[model samples]
Target chain A: MLRREMNAPRDNIVEIRDLHFSRGARKIFDGLNVDIKRGQVTAIMGPSGTGKTTLLRLITRQLRPDHGTIVVDGVDIANLNKAELYKLRKRFGMLFQNGALLTDLSVFENVAFPLREHTNLSNRLIRHVVLTKLHAVGLRGAADMMPGELSGGMARRVALARAMATDPDILIYDEPFVGLDPISMGVIVRLVRRMNDALGISSILVSHDVDEISTVSDCSYLLSDGKVAASGSPDELNRASSELVRQFMHGMADGPVAFHFAAPDYAEQLLGRDSE
Target chain B: MPRELWITFVEFVRTFGALTLFLVELLIQVPRVFVRRFRLIVAQVYNAGSLSLVIIMVCGAFVGGVLALQGYANLTRFNAEDAVGIFAGFALIKELGPVITALLFAGRAGTALASEIGLMKATDQLSAMEMMAVDPIRRVVLPRFLGGVIAMPLLTAVFSMIGLLGAHMVGVMLLSIDVGAFWQQMQSTLDLRDVSEGILKSVVFGVIASLLAVWEGYNAIPTAEGVSRATTRTVVLTAIAVLITDFMITAWFLR
Candidate 1:
């Protein structure tokens, strides 16, 4: 089924090895391992509270794994100093769930931010690059608008432009289709595919929307209980034999995932036990 | 020991340690402001300084008038009514101006900075900056810190000037005390040392207030309620820190 590619070579851009992370007493990722191939669109899908976001944060070096190594490109990020980590970050771009545009900056300035911070480009050149990036997202006309003035979809598009402004080797999108209309979702899917092919950059998409995941991803991983329970092409995921996989993929109500919390019998809890 | 008291003591030590580390980080990033972030520093200065002029002026005028009126009443009993100017000048320049202006700045610009940074964190702007390889402390906090430090002494100076004018209006113009005595006594009592002392106090207070505000904001939990709590903490901690700092600086220099 190609579910576990343990023997994959070292050509992958990102590799996680036996990763373990926890929040206080709550374990999130346990002995998890994943590889992201270069110039491919990979998706991480899971039910609610399955640590999809945490995985992205670990890859970005925002949160260190409690017990393992995350290697980006070739360097083990856990050992990188602040300067080295920042230098490593330049090789990647990320789009947050809510777009995360700087509220004080206009759309144009937001797109120009990375260039202004990292490059010594002239103002004329910066303006040229910023407009070109915004134009790619079809938001050039809204360049002067403030983030508060943008619709959700527009803000997401602007964030996309800003993320790609640095022309990073890898792009990470956290919930790209979240809260989007169908048309907007379609636009994002097309853009992700088009940008991946045109820019020849790898992408890691974190989402639970099955349709969007299948449409945009070259490969997919389904995280369950702090582990990748199943991984394959989108079609293979739809035909996964595991009951947990079927429940999540098909959005079943009564399956391995309980509809209620684990508790004593409902009727006994509602009525006090008779005194013995 | 009471559990609450032990908890409070631990919290105090933790906060003190965190603040010390924050100040160290800020000092490390200070030079970057001049090299790459001059425009941001200028904007922060305008925000923290120019926007604060009116409040400082109005508060200074009222405080000076009250001082002059009370000093005259007390000195009248000693037959030293002409000493009103000296009293107002010494009190305003040596003690009241810097301390009161700091308190007001904490309430005004300090709170504003805290809320702004808190909102940015809640909205994931800080994370986005991190992803872009830009350090938020160097890009955001440094400008505000420098701005506060630059603005504090200037604001204190303005406050003292307006206060003296108010004192003059009360002592000389209204009470018909000899104008010559008023100016003469003020000039004789105040020196470059006293003015410098006041400036130094204000600059230190500025650093404390601005740093505390930004620290609270940056560490605030990313939520609406969390941002509100952080803003409240900025005002409370800034006020307390300013008063304590004023006392320490005053003891070291003024004495």
Candidate 2:
């Protein structure tokens, strides 16, 4: 199935090798290696600030790895110039955590932005395309409304519509289920699967929702300390041997992970007469 | 000595210095910015132009009325009531109209724009735009700047006309200056140079106001609180810049 989706060649749709990123003196992700096969939804699950979003940024070329190679569609994203990078970005869609639609523009205009910007299509054609995409996301009636008016779920869908407006080859969702109610979460997961199937576009879903991840993901990776600590099908992850993975997957708080409270340390110092 | 005062002074310097550096960098990379994102000029024009007509009319009308009263009062004391029309026309076309209109715009659109863009930056919209290969300056700042440029002169023109008319009404109706005499004086004093120079000042004001607002908005840090601070700074600085530029241009032209 992955082979058929690649269509053009055997190369991975998106490949990352030994990618390291640091903010100032602290290293975030180290020697992170991952591959996203064409036509598969790859779920990346990790603890907070373990660099899930950073990984997405690196793949999309919004960030550059200190030392590594990210080849997308057979071209190394690192070497692409500004114009080439722009062209490359056109092939991928990204759903942001907070549905970052332009507040000033109506939903119609928001969705039409990419089409109007990248193509010289006539206004009529652009309107048709925008409405079609909006309808696909079940938001055709909200076209005239501003993004500020929509519910969070609706806004996310609108953003999704805008992301899919350009009919990108790959779609990336950064924490799509964050801050969402269960119903909304279900709707988004279903939409992700539906869109992937309908458009035949490859997707990378980065999330921490274990239940949704298990249900929606074809293959999943456990990212820890900037490396793929473990990776397998969801079923395999359920049967994995890593303690950290098990602790994280079950959402256990009192295992090896300690919740450091500064107050306890201060209290201990005072009670033990260690204070100067 | 108050530490808060010192902190404020330091912050002021930092913001001004950073803005200056940003402007210099913007100037240096202008060619690249333009080449990659020229359509922003059109967008800026549209953003600034839309919804400006009503505010401009209201402000201009009141300003014109006040100009007429002040000019008439001062001129009449000198037994120069005959020059009421001259005072009103020359004052507005040469100086008061453009400066006042721009100051108003700086407060209204400038503050709102800076706050909105600054908040967007805080929320990571700019980052998303960058990821999409969209140039924020081109997609966001350029459109707003161009909009200000287009909107300002039109607003100034409205201001000039309304101010002159208010002066006319004051002179003819209230002060008993003959309509014909007033118009005659206006015809003589309101030369093409006066109109042209006012336009020139307004254009410069437009550039400064838009640049300052957009720059502050673009470089806003922290979060929404940062956006609010940037908005305040944009309004204050742009207002001062408008006043200073107004004086400099007036001195250069009138001298």
Candidate 3:
């Protein structure tokens, strides 16, 4: 979440240049360039199926782009091997869309996963760290419960706790507000800000909720047509000159963006035939 | 024709590279994966192994009853009903224990692993793991594999022993085959190879089931439909692999 520093700002932590990715024959991202600075929340927003998640995958090195480079913390993520990539990923934390907590594990184990995987901390220390993360996310009491027992909001918070368990340098949130109620959304958004401020972690939030994104992100980028079409502060996007960006931000239907529910002449032909 | 062949070869190489990369990733992070989820592994062992106990026992006992019934009827016709205990014990230890149990476990745990991981992949849990720097194969696949490998031999041994006991119960109390005679026949015919073959088959089946489940789960694509497909494939492939291994082991050992 966005947390402004009163003095000086940290340097950029993530940089991508001319990134292109293809899944089979489908081109998902092409010639995409962006920079995610440290100690700030950058929201990437787009419609569904516009490859918002794919872009995140590329940044995280889960899916390598067909062309171009992604550098995080002065290292090219693309050039790293599996082992090196695993090490690099230790710097990253992610809150998935569905709060992907392992169904078989308790909430305590879920939060402790990253710590146990990457560190040699004693069980006592691991417990302390896990409970601290849980407490940060306001779920310290639910540590022993199974994922299935938790509500949707609780599960997402557990996932957030697990994401931060290892004290990652970078945090990525994929649609944190998608399925939550207003209260839950408020809790998560607040926790994101609180955790970022408390831990000073860099974050990239991918969301479609413009209002929430506006409230939480210092900078926002609109991804469309396999590229970042517009990017700036929320005010910049709200008053952007680009027609497409304006249509998207204001949610206007009578713009260049079409629904494509029918072919150009299908509706007209159907109506004419019915009249005849 | 040459161009097509070249394309096919390149595709094969790419697939091989992906698999090799996955294996290398798994190998590197193995310790972390196991250490982190040791509790889950223990829980899975209890869930999978304990829940399957009654079925294993029932099948073993029922199979033993049938073996005794059939062996008594056939061998008595030739005035060699004394061989009933020997044949039943040898068959149970050599073939039924490993093969039947593997088939059962594949249907139970193998399918479950495939579907569970597949669903996780479908829902982006695998991606979540990646972002968290958690190794899915080591954390998820390896533990389930270990469970099957560890549980299979124990379950099979239990099955074989119980089956033999069931045979003995019927053979002595009802069939009137002398208990002393039965023990003598088994002592004379039973060898370590017979018992070892079943354990060996179980190990192979365990490896195959785990590999299949992990492979399918790793390659799972979008949609819960893909997970369903992986579950079916895991069961069928594991069962078939178990049968093939059983035949190979039986032939090598029996001969």
Candidate 4:
């Protein structure tokens, strides 16, 4: 019943409305709308360079939108001062694609990082909390090991442990499955689902692994050309008739989305007028 | 050419303004960092200070011996070989010590700080800290800045002391100058003013070197080439700034 009730209209943990963003002269998001429902794994699926990571940045107020409002739990992050923004960010646990564990610190200390910074927890308490989080990610045995020693998946798991140490209300994964071996991918996929339901917190995943996204996501949005090409249950997206959605879901080499970048005619460039 | 000159001038002003702002931000974060980040600062002192000790000492000894040998040869022309001690001491305390130590600091600790921070930025560790509600400026940058600034004056003092001994080794033991005359000349002529000048120069150089190191590292483009470039810039900028400031400080003291 609790999971079913997440489909209600007013349950969004983050709401983006009429979003507009750009990097220099190039547009990123144009009137994009997205909702991350409370207590569910919502995936933002897109082709590469569609600004999925940028969307995550905007959600956490790392970059301000050109025009539009992002409401994270009824607070418009556009106007938060530095102190206020940091306070708001305490609610989020973000796992970067490369894991981003502090190299100077060991696995345990890396997980203990946020706790040490934000809370005045005793050393014993911090250790307990760190080990607990590490255990949750199945990395308790690797607590004293340095980050450089961990495999990519293990490093990602350690990063996940670090991210969750502060008990954030929202867990964000930025391309979590990139370059992961299938076993590690399955482990991460299971953890993503388990963490969301087990903790009863929201998870916003930015990924393009359609199979993993379909398996783990409660709802998915496919983005193309600065807009949500389609959004619904993965099955619904799979069943959709739109060319962009079909091309992305099926991983077609060429479709409405051309493999070649937009440029001057290839023949014209080859047979240059300058040759005369 | 005019356009290029104008562009260079504009870039200079922009970097100057940015560096000033960065210095101010570190100052503002001072109380917060010092309050709880003392261990981090101490560790950085060990990193930027003790770790750089061997290089600093070796160079100081060699520089002192060279100065003494040269000063003795010059003084011998006028039968004033005793003043070799004064010459070496004056040069080491007032000019060479601070300038050379700062240069070495730039080469040793400065490169370390820049490359470490740059790599962290490349790996997104700094961004991760930011996302976790921890300010990297307070946690990472400020402590290192404090470490270098604290270490510089001390390192300069150590360098001058060790250089005097080096001068003694060459001038008194090897060159066979009258030991009493060499010792007396240095003790009397090398007044508090010379010591103060050395300390002042070192502190200033420390601030400049440390500030530049952290600035280049923090603003480095997050890539291997970028980090390498940041490290190179940290060394180059700090070396140039130390030399220019040495002349300026010496001139000011003379006036």
Candidate 5:
């Protein structure tokens, strides 16, 4: 990944306003607004099924919002046509929850993919760039191996390398720590911070792992009811007033997000004692 | 009007519209894939063409043998045993080559294309590519589609050639048919029209099979069961389409 000038402090790299999205009849984001500052790690945390990944999709223009606007680097993404949107997307690198390395390609080819597609770098230079990226993720030795031959954590690291291959202006990680060992989780968290600082790029990390977010992110937002319930540093969120934030931060099972699926009274249903 | 029925109708229309649009996009990208991504296309050609060679060859040869046996028996009863070679050649060239090759392609290459792309969608590899500013349609779908299209006709040619050779072997060696009449009668009887009809059918089937494979895949729901369903749909739809197109083409060509 190429190094770039650090973004101006306190300037926002991404901004959303009055965002609304729905799946069929269910609304996911209603009048939601959030901002990601330039050259910083911003963690978007929420409960399961709260549309953390959906928000990332909306930002990346993978899924358009039903209404409202998303501005990336001050360009209204909603208005961009496919070609313009693709041009805008060149600035973003996303890591999916499952790593999502190309199964048919070797680890080196996977990392080299974006570069080869987007750049005309010669063979020798492509190899150097690929190796540099793989080296950054500590998987240079495993470059020739197929993705299937790599472990879950190794796959994630290679995906990280691929994500960083083109030196994007912004990096988006959608549940990067979802299915990793604790050591892997620690490595990813450290990489998120280090890559952001070293490359001077903003990163949007969508994760619910409180500890990892706390360790990695410069700013954190806890979402509840399609809006930010709390926004601050980890310590600030821990001492926040919102019940939902407290439950999320502490991993409490039952709070604003219910533990049940809104069914009829359980005992009554089982006994058939309640009239329709 | 029941709600379920209404929903199904709407879903059908939506899928139809999507497929039509996808067909147009594939048409546009097929030529582009040929121009820039020659290596990718070649790799997929090896996958769909070279990998399916054995099954296509074995089935074609067996079919030819069966055809020769049946033709010899029937022709001998009529005291026109020399027509057996002509019979096998006409049947193989006009119908079996294109139809069976397509069915086999559906089973072999078609299923592979659908499942591979479906898995890629489910795993978010396509989305990752989009985020990397690469069009998955151009980079992934088109190469595979082009390969399948290129492979379909070549496989048909291979199947026909091998099938004819098998018929010749069985006709001369097993049935005691005259070697000269076996080949010479068939060659004289089979004209350009017959060969062109076969190639035309293969070309149409190629487009349909390749297009549907990638269509079902690129639009697959991103889940295990979704991918399985898409793969199944690719085979079923391609089979039905191949049959329908074959009948239509034969009727038109004969007319």
Candidate 6:
């Protein structure tokens, strides 16, 4: 019986402060902070390997930060115990990059899983609810299909149905629009907008596809070098003067992110000037 | 040298600690699984036990036949052909039944469990369960563990029964030994202690094999190659562990 507070001030559902995380010798996030506003689609845009997925994992408490607190639903997740962390996660649903459907189950059963596990619904009721969820994503006809039998877009839609099966208050989409045809991409965009508004749920979309993000996202954050390089509406982002933001938004080949790996100067190396 | 030793010691402690925690968590979830998801446990029993019956029966018959042949050959030279039943019965009930059943179970069901769970982890199904407020250990591992424990004794009993039948067939029908003497000797020589000991061994082997399989799968690297490696490790480690546990149980029983 989770209900969204639609009229509530668009306060932050998730907030990070002075976050620091590293892998081996490389630092990914340093003193990073971001806020996911309630009841809105917040698109996180970044170049490849800029900790966008890591940010989602951090919010879900799947990965811990080396420093700083991730406050989800007003509770500091870093301080929550195992039982508390799981309770916190129940409020959030995530659509993984690869769909991540349970391959052993059919489309119907995949969406029915969370309901069966968490609720006391009868089989008849479960079936009814599963069909309703699948219908939300225009996949009611595909309910009996197996994950492998579906196309990538179909699988993504089924995954979306499964993610929203429990009617979570927050939905996190990691590369939801990747690897889809134009029609499929459009369907997903419309569904994201429709579902967010219809269910009155907050959403966080992490994608590199700027056109789609600009079309669907209410507000967007461009992450660069472990911080928010730019934050604005899609129009504002497109019009921003930051070269890094512009390079990313325009999908330029040469900019802040080099086109080639660093190496010795070509002429000097070819001439073998110093032999050192 | 000191640093190397220190690192090794630290690694040992860490691994031991993790394993202890995993077992504790598994044990804690066992009752919850039985109470809430008894149907899952039943399904696993069918998967881990009933699916394994044909192989265990086939192996049991062959092993018994071979033992009868070898025992008859050796004992006939000493004019002790009548002792074939005693030899085969003792061997099957006391040792071969449990040990061979365990080895076969490890190769078949243990590897399958590992790969299945590993694939689930690789596909993020376990994480999905976690996000839905369900403990994967309770939903996935506990039933499998209990299923293995329950299946081991039943499979071992089947192996023993089939082996005894094979021995009787070989010793009485093929070898022209007296059927009455064969049955009578086996019945008298096989004690309750012997049967119970085999059951205990199979149960312990079941725990070791299933726990190791689930642990490997749960901790696998979540990749194709990682799942493959976890399956291989399940078989190899379960086999070695079964053998070691058999030795310890036997030594204790004998002492």
lDDT pick, better of 1 and 2: 1
For model 2, the stretches where C-alpha displacement exceeds 4 angstroms are A1-10, A24-26, A120-136, A140-144, A179-184, A194-199, A260-276, B1-52, B122-133
Q: Model 4, residue A139: displacement in angstroms?
A: 1.6
- Give the chain B TM-score for each candidate: 0.96, 0.85, 0.84, 0.98, 0.94, 0.94
lDDT for every model?
Answer: 0.90, 0.83, 0.82, 0.93, 0.90, 0.89
User: Lowest summed-lDDT stretch of 10 residues in model 5 chain A?
Assistant: A1-10
Q: What is the fnat of model 2 with respect to the true interface contacts?
A: 0.36
Tens-digit lDDT track of model 3 for A101-210: 88767999988877876789999999999998898778899998999999887899899889888888889998899888888788888877777788898889999898
The per-residue C-alpha lDDT of model 3 at residue B48 equals: 63
- For each candidate, what's the DockQ? 0.90, 0.42, 0.66, 0.82, 0.80, 0.64
> In candidate 4, which residue ranges exceed 4 Å CA deviation?
A1-10, A263-276
Candidate 1 ranges with C-alpha deviation above 4 Å: A1-9, A261-276, B2-4
Task: Give lDDT tens digits, candidate 6, residues A1-276.
Answer: 234564445489889999999888888998888988889999999998899999998888888999999888777898889888888888888898878788878999999988988789999999998999898788999988899999888888898999998899999999999888888788889989988999899999999999999999999999988888999899999999989988999989978877667788889989997477
lDDT tens string, model 6, B1-255? 999999999997997689779888888877878899999899999999977899999999989888888888899999988888888999998899999999999889998899989999998888778777778888888899889888988999999889988887888889987887777888898899988898899888888888888888898889999999999988898888789889999999999
What value does DockQ give for candidate 5?
A: 0.80
In candidate 5, residue B233 scores what lDDT? 96
CAPRI-style class, candidate 2: acceptable
- Candidate 5, residues A132-244: lDDT per residue as tens digits? 98887788999999999988888988999998988999999988987788877777788889999999999999988898888889899888777777898888998998788
User: What are the iRMS values of all candidates?
Assistant: 0.4, 1.4, 1.3, 0.5, 0.8, 1.3
lDDT of 2 by residue, B1-255 (tens): 699999999998997788777667556656665676666665666666555666777777777777778777887788888887888788788888888888888888888788878988876677767756677766776666666777788878887888778777767887788898889978976788888999999888888888888888887884867888999989898988888888888899869
Per-residue lDDT of model 1, residues B1-255, tens digit only: 699999999999998998999899888878867778888988998999876889999999999898889999899999999999999998999889998998888888888888899999999999999999999888887888888888888899999999999998988888877899998988998899988888888888888888888898888998999999999999899888888887888888846
Model 2 TM-score on a 0 to 1 scale? 0.83
Question: RMSD of each candidate?
Answer: 3.5, 4.8, 5.0, 3.1, 3.6, 3.4
Candidate 1 colliding pairs: none
Ranked candidates, highest DockQ first: 1, 4, 5, 3, 6, 2
lDDT per residue (tens digit) for residues A1-276 in model 2: 877775767446889988889999879988888988888889999988788998998999888889999999788999999889988998888888888888778999989988877899999999999999888777899999998899988888888888898889999998888877777678778988888888888999999999899988888999887789789899999888788888888888865445453354676687886664
